[model samples]
Target: MADTIDEKTGTGRTEQIRDTSSSDRDFRLEEIDLNSNRDAKIKNPLAGIPHDALMRNVEDFAREREMTDLTDLLKKGAQIAQRPSEFETIEGLTDREREVLRDEVLHRWRQPKALYFTVILCSIGAAVQGWDQTGSNGANLSFPQEFGIPDTEFLDAAKTIPNPNFTHNLWLVGLINGAPYLASALLGCWISDPLNNFFGRRGVIFFSGIFCLLSVIGSGLSQNWWELFITRILLGIGMGSKASTIPIYAAENVPASIRGGLVMCWQLWTAFGIFLGFSANLAVQDVGRITWRLQLGSAFIPAIPLVIGIYYCPESPRWYMKKGMYRKAYNSYIRLRNDPVLAARDLYYVHAQLIEESHIIGKSSYLVRFVELFTIPRVRRATLASFTVMLAQQMCGINIIAFYSSSVFVQAGSSPRTALLASWGFGLVNFVFAFPAVWTIDTFGRRALLLFTFPNMAWTLLACGLCFYIPEDSKAHLGMIALFIFLFAAFYSPGEGPVPFTYSAEVFPLSHREVGMSWAVATCLFWAFVLSLTWPRMVAAMTPTGAFGFYAGLNVTALVMIFFWVPETKQRTLEELDYIFAVPTAKHMRYQANVAFPYFVQKYIVRNKNAKLEPLYQMDKNLAEGQARSASISEKP
Candidate 1:
């Protein structure tokens, strides 16, 4: 023990002789100097040294005294060096190991069954989004009869007379219906960030669920279109909140490996919800005027599950980290993961990555941050691509098809009931094909699918337009239009429908994720508003052929833009993508490709030689280190 003390004190140096063998293994000497300000050159007695350095010295002494092998010394040194700070390096974990750690952490928070149940619960919000959007489609089918409104003939006559009163009422109905979405978009921009900060993801979701419940009830009990419009506005507010927060919540909670799949569930349920709304509306179409009310009111049912189940769902560990609640974040990670050791490791890695990334992109005012989005060339390209894709999705005549399907059918010589049922069939087809999107999105990659589907959609729309040119007396022509509509919906399910959201969410950096997504959605809504407002007029002018032809033309334009611009984003992680596009060469390629494809590809492909793949390599290293640290910590006891 005397010789041990002498050696540990370093070469004949005398230090305080304290025996703490009786206490816990974690015992430490109070007088040992490990402060950062300690003199570096000091060799005097009681010279302050870092705890790490002292541990190394002690371990070295032990090795010399015991004639230990290098492996044994390293193992002993690791045990002695195990401190809070030593767990920071986790970038060395293997993919399988990281996944194991991720799973372990998730299991710690909740049972596997409960985790899956959370997915189902959160999907309610998704369903509500779908139902709300399409519910009006079916309602429009019966709205003219129920309200004693002029049918298309009377409305056309009313339009010709051009009485200011009749024109005002027409505009009023559009306002009442359109006003909510406008308000919701504005509110979404203002409320989402602050609400996320104030109420937490779960809280905001719960509050939105309450709003949905009330809106559905109010819409159900509406005495007039004006009253229903007010309810729709309220519902729109809820939808806006859902749009901003649901993806954030889902992204934050899910492990990276399964995140895309889990988030896609939101889209899946949304399609299902549309199907349900359309089917329900069809079932009650002949029942009475109240059928539309029942259809609109049924949106409330899903909110119950959201409100109840959200309470059990944990707040995002990422959000907790953002709040600097490291311990709380770790605990949440544990809940999400179900393993303390793995949770600790993941929590540290997540913290490090977030902090490092945030530091690189300096914290700035919201306006500055927004400006930065366009200032960075790569980010700009991504932003524009996102905006264009969403714009194309809305402008491609899907909404027109949805909102005026019954009217279209009437022109094609189908009764209102048959037309409404056909609309329901469209929704059902959309729902069925949505599953393929989930399976293929990650497997086949985004660019390939977009490239394939856009042309098909264009051709289908062209065929439908030609069908409209066929004489109204021909049943075969009408049959072709119906078949084409089904094909259009199916093609859309795997293409524009799910891919826009997926791409928008993927291309932005972590810091700009929420803002980018919000902007994309805002763009979608803005175009949707334009299309919705103009669609009735366009359909009336072109008599379906001109409108479908115009949309088909837009589809062709979208195909050209997508073929040159969008990159394959399937299977790649966000971090990996960030690194790939961070270089000057990649950045140039990204923008130039958007404008001129072949030249951009040639130049960028050559420059790809200079593209450094270090970030991905570093990320893999960090993950491995994290897993090893987790394993070490788990084995400590």
Candidate 2:
């Protein structure tokens, strides 16, 4: 379609075809999308222009924008963006610019102070979200009783007594505990589209933080379960909006090389906040009637820093560009990048890609763009991929543990004290294990980690449930149950924990990102709402063993969904991903099942050292590699 680049020269070339049929157009589009990465050879719309002509165009572009002072810098920047790795030959290159450019690749993690501050702000928002969740976990033990709505009472290890109004109490308690997620799914997440449209990313986060503060205060002061429910309903709005916005905000600002790790800070710090929430739960579990109040209210602490610090952070430069504030976007980029030259390169490069993106997903009414998330082919693929990851997150049953691990431990013959301790142990394991993913995610890539860990999670959860069959009289019973759950958390924290949000945030084109993310987060939180709402009743009826075993089975199903639908996005920039998502789901599925599986079986299962596994979409060091792959696949029996 637009243009193609030579891998060695980074110069554009065009090929003529007599066919103008829609099928041919579609074929060319696939070529651009599927050839996304060939050892850094990608379609560049700006390629093949002569240096003099490109510089002249840059001069005119700057003059029109009242940026003539930056004309020299802009010329060099444009040249570099066209041929990123071959900047050494670009004319008018100063030693300082050259050194900075080199440093960008060598020290990608070495970023501007403002960029890190932005990440911290986003992370704080995530912590607020995580903390809000744990408050209810600990508060659940005591709040219902205080409100004259105790759901149950245990007389012995295996025998539990339901309250006379147990059915009503169970629904109310679940409703109260699950209020935030419910509000998030139904209202808060969807509103993010409009909020982001009007208030910008920072504004949505700021307002959400304010909501979180109000809800936490109201929950602590509520005198009844219904009052607590209403208050948490308010908290859900904040949680939904904040959850939708934070990952997108973080992903937009970070470099692609380490994007997985940086964007995943949302989950890592959320786990830390979960740790803090559980810590608060432990600290106040013995405070008599006030324990639950303190647990519920302490969640407000993380929100305070989030609201205050977000103002100091720069808005996403891409957002600035979308809003047509070019000068302001460039200024934001200056503070974000380590050097002005790098800033210039990114600004122009992103702008060029955005132009191409606009052709694919044009500016339309909000409703049209929202509809495009499913109706447009490329955007629809992103929606499906994002939906798969988000749905898989819920199906993996992490939220079951997150929302009701304390209850689960209590049901397994643990005393109130032992349950809180075990919940704390799970929290600690969740937080501690998440640290390794920060490095490993970027290294191993998101898809590999998910595939490797899901089976492990499924088995561990099954083992945990089976351990419930071990007689309570056996000293090994409780200890064995805790061990398996901790192991499950270990697998979950790295794989599914960090992936869904980070993956969803970066998949959609900027035009539809707000709405696309709204859909993705809604899917996640809505399912979370269902899980939280139903689990107490489900566990009560089915018993912990059956309920846990049910979800363990779900883990395997999620793994399969992930294998076919989710694609690897490691080290690819936000715009380059346009092509990645453009790939049809059916095609991607075929590649995974028919090609990737057989190759994996040959290499890993059969231990055939000489086995050659042709990559699915990737082109190796040369052009013939991709051709050979296509020919090999076609010849496959």
Candidate 3:
């Protein structure tokens, strides 16, 4: 039998025993050095030892095997096994780090290059959202007049409606716009997983862009209201897919440090697109209703770039790893990182960690996965957080401003043309102020902004609502209301407008993120439908003042929820967030870590000190130990 050798030193030793008689076999063993280091070699004897003798020897050895040591060995073995997988993860990275040496590789990605591409691509999708949303706004304004209905006939038809008021109309319009959003939200949830599964994220995006273009054209060419509504529904489906998939694509592809910044670009582009649409409307206001068709039709320009530009974009490395296509994933990683070896190493690390933390949840059926979101506490919290944020977003009455600004201004005593121009100003303010949100979402964090701005928004709306209650012939009161309206838009664009979208994308884990965001967005759509359907009636009943006040109250409720529940997620890495929220105790504790919390409470909150700080520190330590172990193992051969 071959004798086992000690691995640390390539040395051999022999064990000898005396024979009692000639009949007794002579027991002699000589150690031979093996070319590799394996624990199994150290574990077994040359010949089978009796159970009693093995037990005796173990008792005499004095040192028992430790669970921690066993754990470390298992972890080390896993690290070694995954060394080849590191290459697969690099495809998810941006261009700046592609040139770095393996030894010098760091987790912080090169920002401008990777983030710039992410911003640019995601911006394309967001522009589509803005154009589609605002296109409808501009189209509706002209549709009433261009259809050749008398003003009295239009108002009479509107009055005959079940909810015959400004609030009811506002709510109804919200519902109409939200109908497509609802479909998009729900479809976005299911389509994201499979679309990503078969064609990859880039492919899904390319297809969605095509759909958006077609929908826009369909909307522009519609000769009737019903045709326009159907096209809008189609456009909603496209928007839903884009809304769900694009954020996941951007979030997964960027480095942890700048992920927030890149995702915020989606909002920035949305605002810019709305502004552009409004600008187009203002420029062509006197050029006849055909200009509205042109404005609505022009969304095709950006859709073309989105489809073509996405063709060159790489698939998410994480998705590639999940599918077990390691080699292809590796090649993609290399292309993305511009370094094969380093790509392999990072891919291996991510794969090993994924395997270690693997759960059965992700492999389940779609309905099962969807159900699990509500059943599991952490997932439930995440889902609710997303939903609540989106609900708050819609309830803030911003959509009423977007869809009914002309109506609201006319009620405020402005002429029809002046009201339309003021509506354009609202879009312009939305565009200009959105930049501050994009700039501060990462810096100020989600909860901070929410807490700070929501109350002000509520007050602004309340003041505007009160202004409506003022008697007519008060131009001074009207001036005050107009100033407050401008302030309302300014506050909303920088705060509520961007945060809902950003928060929905950030709070959920990657495994269920798409579905979670889909549901949240869907919730927005549902409420939008309710608000739109009822807004006209509410406005008719209470006029503009009472309608604005009702929404202001809802904003206050949203503020209370945000102050107590929302978390600060500005700089957390995906992995760190995963581990931080995995534990039941940690999950609830983290919800209170927002920067706006009291200092003493922030420090002393249960598990806040340990739970919040420990995972990130441990992640770093584990990653370091894993790298060291890999180096030791790789050095042997």
Candidate 4:
């Protein structure tokens, strides 16, 4: 094992790290070959340096960062990175350090309360996000007539009188319904980079929370449709920025072992917010004209905890390190991890990887980094994958239901009260089903869950659309519509619903995280804007069956795109993803078409006894090779 011990981790630090200094380096050093496959392995940056030299370098790192007090810990951590099994045997190691190291592995999920608290705070922010998106859903039924906006009666059985301005009014209602996403796409998401740069994750969330609170209050108080549309636009600033920052904040502080499941709280709680929004609609459904206002304004409740509680949560350790605040980063890491050794190990490993990234990606202005997202090979693949997930999210057609479910129910022939109640059922199923992903997302994994569920979502959504053709007079017609819609939500909750946000959050190098996420969120929200704006017209032109069928076809297209373009990221450290995205896209696509597809047919479809599937990516021990996404599903960690 290259004379290095790894009692818990698989194998020892590789000779590849040492060979970097040799004339005949196998992997090119000009840039990490962030090719298209997960099979490519990266040499550990900490692999080969001699103990004394490494200690000297560690000392230099500590001194330069004004963290000299941590020099000894840093040196030990480098030793752990270079040789983990020998961590128990490292020179001058205390019993407590050894015990803590063991605890880190055995109690992977037994995290510090502070860490879980931080995740909760981030989840609350997501709840605020979900509440914002859906508050207007129930309000959509009542608010149009109050503000003279066009109604959906022309498209469905529950038609209002044919007004002369029906076409213009329909477009106007769509415009208002879609304003938040338009504002988010055009303005709010793009600004997240600068905001995150200036305020850090916590501060950006606080800023967004205040905006969310104020905007919801403003929506409730608006006297006209235009005023309400403007308020929704203002709300998008909060929604977009919060969406960009919270998952990243949660990802940065958590351990990689459970990162997916924990980060998934964003989707889980957001579903809860949606459910609550629907419930609030029912609570005040009988309160007369002001009921719409209550539904629109009640979203401010979740934002209250978000703005007030952010200060109590620790800032991201990576953010502090990026800003050159090593001492503060260490403190934050300490609070976030259970033991000092664990914290030290993460801090130093992340520091080393960041240094490697600077050499690979090159540090520069935000614009330069933004440019590099496409210019750099590794970052570009990440950009492509991030874009795919975000775009597929809208393409899957989940938002059409989310943004307009009540109206959809009314069109399906339910009474207004029955429609609102049915929408609540949709919300409940969405929230309840998301719970499974909190476990499976880490086990079955992000890519697998998405792959498995997309087809189900497609068929179910198609079923919903087709059910629209059933005669409205039959009691079975309304029941079937509600059933298929809920089924669509069920399929959506565990896969597309959470994967996009979580996947986008972790795919980029820290240097480009803010801007990369902005691009991704913008892609998602922009398409969402398109869907919200065009659905009224599309449904008007295509009928519910045609509209739903079109998106179901889109869901299939999205599934194909995901299989070809999206890489699995389950169980990977944020820093470790550099290697995951390094393989060229051509290489990744070739593996899937030539190797993965063949293996799938042999193993799952053909049921061949001897067919074996080989992993495409190879990682050094320093990156925790065995704990990666390449591990077999039946294999224990």
Candidate 5:
């Protein structure tokens, strides 16, 4: 039995009992000398190191890798067991020293002081989106009066002469509410790809910040609807580019473990900006003619931090690699990561993936590549994933609350002052709920959160619609409606709010990331344009109950799409994701999930099937089998 255990372990016995059985001594299995049997499965490279010291190294490696699972532990252990030449660290050190040093540096890389600050800085672009949402929400309350809008029933009363321009007035309001979104969709979707390719992520952010700054100022100073509309168009262009650029920038810089949380900071800042925008609205609500103007212009404040802070940040190392600037990519990698060894390893994977992508695409024009995005199965899966997630986000009706919460409150029978205050409550709820997503995103995974929260959102929207059936002044009605609206925010914030952006950032390879994300964000802007242009008209025509009921139905569709189409992206390295997306599983998952439970399909259905038909899976299986057979023959000999 002892010889068999030793043989199975692929190690020789070094510590043996000397005739202890004759002396009535008990036999015990002693701890293996990890250093002696270098190829043994349970060997520890840092065997002689203090337990605390070894643990510290482990902790450091965990942080760099963003280690959240036992798989990470096993992988790291197997990696550490490799011989000196097999390691990615500096060549001179012994295997044990190299392992410990590699881990120490990885810890440093994970918590890099400058890189995190850079990520936060880039995320300010999202603050602009939030600021714009609430600013417009508040501004809409007062801007109508200044523009001769027939806001009250008195304008059509028998005693008063009817306004001839009421139709024109409503058109202008739709224009004002929707122009930025339209421009953002058109320009942001199309223009971001070229700008990102030509100038890089940091340059696009800086340019967008400037556009936001000038446009907000122009919006504030406008004397007529046209002036404000044109400025908003410019603002939309800036936001369009920024929205597409920031997430890519952050994802390219961080480790896969923390990448979801870090990229979600975009949503976090956006929530913060929403809270500030609402507060700004409340602060200037009594300023007479300038109240709406102040709200519109207050967005400029967040842009300053974005512009100043972006200058200090490094461009994505992947971007540098794509452009054939290897030295620059290496330097950026070093600056972004904790140690040169990890940097080298990460860069190696990035280069390999980029090369593979290039080989698959061959030498194609930008137009050809863009066209091929639809033609390639792997790339199309990513594109469709990004598009679907963005579509789901807009269809959920979260933006309806963000863009017109104040108006919804008024429609619910609250006074204008009460409506603005209630909007603030919505803003606070949005901000608070977003924090939990930062933790849950990387921990529980993306698909799980969407599956869990989307149903709550759909039901809550229905409840909100039901509230409109009650008498307007009743406390029960108002309280129930407000509770439902807040509940909708609670559900939307953690799931739809961050997932779309983070998921879009994840699905695309570096070669297509910029254009892919741009299109995804464009899809968001397009739907936002639809909702902004139609919501008021929908409410006026169908009543708030019918309008919200429509939104609830859309949420149901979104839930179906998410359950069927979206794959779990948590814990995967960006390069590794290339392989996963290449598999023809998304369509199969969608079909199976539509037929049954998605969780069961993911856990049991997919794993249980033999994948040996696929060439890659077949090759891997054959190679593994061959190795096992060879090992058995050697053992027999």
Candidate 6:
């Protein structure tokens, strides 16, 4: 063991012993002197730079290292052979891999896992909104007893009977049901933008969950209608704020490839929450007066995951980038994109866009930012598109079905128990149908879905109105009404229900996204308030038939507006769509059906032989070429 251990040191030990004849020539720690003054003067050199700048440097170093590694690998064979092959020089990847990598760098491929967990966590905010809406539907069945309204009067009244509080009670029900949206339309519209600016997208959503929890508790524990109304208003503030913020938040964090599907998860999860609410309602239906309390309180359950889970989620990189927190944005962008190359590429684009936006809206106040949405030609057109989609969504009257499902089923000639069961079925169908939009929204195109589904919903709603006109109530009549209602869910869920929120989120640029979306959500809340506040009176005055007929006609108007104004936003990057809305609204609207729509049909379909679409395609080609020429000329100066 000694011989083996000493064998390697034998020659070195002899040389050291020979050289140690003079100890002054020996190595010593003292000989290697430290500059004490210099060290003392600079205790922590990193402290001289701002934290954000330091972080940006770190990110830049990491990105450079990645690039260096890629460059070295690509040049390795060429350097050794002194001759670079075309195939070998393609970014350290094979031809097929290079193509895929190029697509990823361009942000074209679907990447779900990287952002899925975070997006789903954010979607719980939407679920909270749905829970409040549908849970209240079940709660309305029983809350009247606690509030001094008779079980068999007003909403539950089998036959019209004279009651002292009939008109007052009906209005009170409308107020209670519509209070959240009223608060959302008023208070929420004002707060959502400022809160988003001050606290960021995630922070506002976090606060929304807190508001939901506390307000739900207040609502469930209310001793009187006034108390419940106030709490419901608070709850509305939370829901309304979420409506405006969550979609943009999710959209900014996700890749544009899966953006529509992920953002539409807002509605998808809301439907899930509604299903939970209806199930909760069914569970407690026999619990006497406490049934309503349990139903209302159940909204708090989803708020738990929302508040707790959101902390683990990263803030939007675009939000950080907008605030000039480059390091934070880079870090977040990296975390959100698993591919380092793709992350670096997307971060660069975000930086470029921020600079462009700053140039465009220099020193503009927040109010001016909103005004520019109406005054700037491109932004104004986009606003109109967003506004119409949101308005159309609400005008489709899905909320009427959600808020008054119990009453509608009761009016359709079902017993109270049977009506409650039917409400559960409606909630299930609503939840299940939303899954299709997850697949179709990114595939079939938003404009097509809206155009096709609106007519089906209108016809189904018309049939529902016709069903109520049957003089004698029969199983066939009830079944027909139920079928129409189901069909409405089937059509609306995949199209109008999810598309509006997704579309509105997409059209607005980063600078005005929050305020723009807030306006859109305000439109939704306004219509929600309108429908909720007036439905009882409308049903009382016009009968259910005329009420549904009004909604049917509204759907038709929505269909027309969508066809004329809304552009197809399938498979396009968020920034790439600027030109689509840049044209004058008057010109586009005048020629859309005659010139644009046919070209869309020809390009997306009829690829082999299509003479009917040729003229339309040529017209569109000329229009686009002319616009490009004018833009280039304008820029040349």
lDDT of 2 by residue, 306-397 (tens): 88889898888887667655577788889888888877777777876776676555566778877888788888888999999999999999
- By TM-score rank, best first, the candidates go 4, 2, 6, 5, 1, 3
In Å, residue 332's CA in model 5 sits off its true spot by 0.9
**Which ranking of candidates, highest lDDT first?**
4, 2, 5, 6, 1, 3
Per-candidate alpha-carbon RMSD to the true structure: 13.1, 7.7, 14.2, 6.6, 15.1, 16.7
List lDDT for all candidates, in order: 0.61, 0.81, 0.60, 0.83, 0.71, 0.71
**Worst lDDT window (10 residues) for model 4?**
15-24
Runs of candidate 3 with Cα error greater than 4 angstroms are 1-115, 145-176, 186-189, 330-346, 360-362, 469-479, 583-637
- Candidate 5 clash pair list: 109-338
Per-residue lDDT of model 1, residues 1-637, tens digit only: 0111232332332222231122212332222111111221111111233445544544443343342333232333232223322333333434554445444433322335445666676678888877777667666655645655434542242125434354444444345445556756666544665577557778888888888888988888888777787788787777777776777677666655455566677777888888887777787788786887887788787788888889888787766655544445655766765334445445433432343245345354456656877776546656777777788787667777665666676667677788887888888888898888766776576666777788888888888878976776787866888899989988988778777776776667655666666777777766666675565555555657777888989998988777655655554445434543343434334544554454444557765554433111122333344445555654654
415 Cα displacement, candidate 4 (Å): 0.7
Over 71-134, each residue of candidate 5 has an lDDT whose tens digit, in order, gives 2332333233222223444234456545544443243234677688887796677888789777
Number of the top-ranking candidate, with lDDT as the measure: 4
- Single out the weakest 10-residue window by summed lDDT for candidate 5: 16-25
For model 6, the superposed segments whose C-alpha errors exceed 4 Å read: 1-114, 150-164, 471-473, 596-637
How accurate locally is residue 599 in candidate 4, as Cα lDDT from 0 to 100?
97
Tens-digit per-residue lDDT, 1-637, candidate 4: 0122232463443221122222222222323444333457755656656676677677777776677888788778778866765676688678888777666566667889999999999989988888888888898888888987648663462345546777777778778878889988888887888898777899999989999999999999999988998999999998888888898899899988789999989999999999988998888999999989999999999999889999999999998777666688899999998777777888888877776676566556778877887888889999999999999999999888888898888888888899889999999999999999988998888989999999999999889988887888898999999999999999999999889999999999898898999889989999999998888778777788899999999999999999999989997789878888887888788889999999999989999989998877766764554343224323446
Model 4 residue 398 distance off true place after TM-score fit, in angstroms? 0.6
For lDDT, candidate 1 versus 5, the one ahead is: 5
TM-score of predicted model 5? 0.78
Candidate 6 C-alpha error for residue 393, in Å: 1.4
Colliding residue pairs in candidate 2: 12-48, 180-236
Better of 2 and 4 by TM-score: 4
Q: What is the lDDT of residue 78 in candidate 6?
A: 20
lDDT per residue, candidate 6, 1-637, as tens digits? 0001123243311111111112222211122111111111101112123323433443443353243333333232222111111223534444554444434434444454647778888678888888889877877777876898643455534357637777666677888989999999888866888898778888998888898999988899999988999999999888888889889888888876678888999989888888888888888888887888888988899999998988788898877656545456666866787544445556554443333334344434578878988876657777899889989988898988899888788777787677778888888999999999997998798888898899999999999988876653566877788889989998988999889888888787777788889888888888898888888767766778898999999999999999888867765456545545554566556577676677767766767355354221111232234334434443553
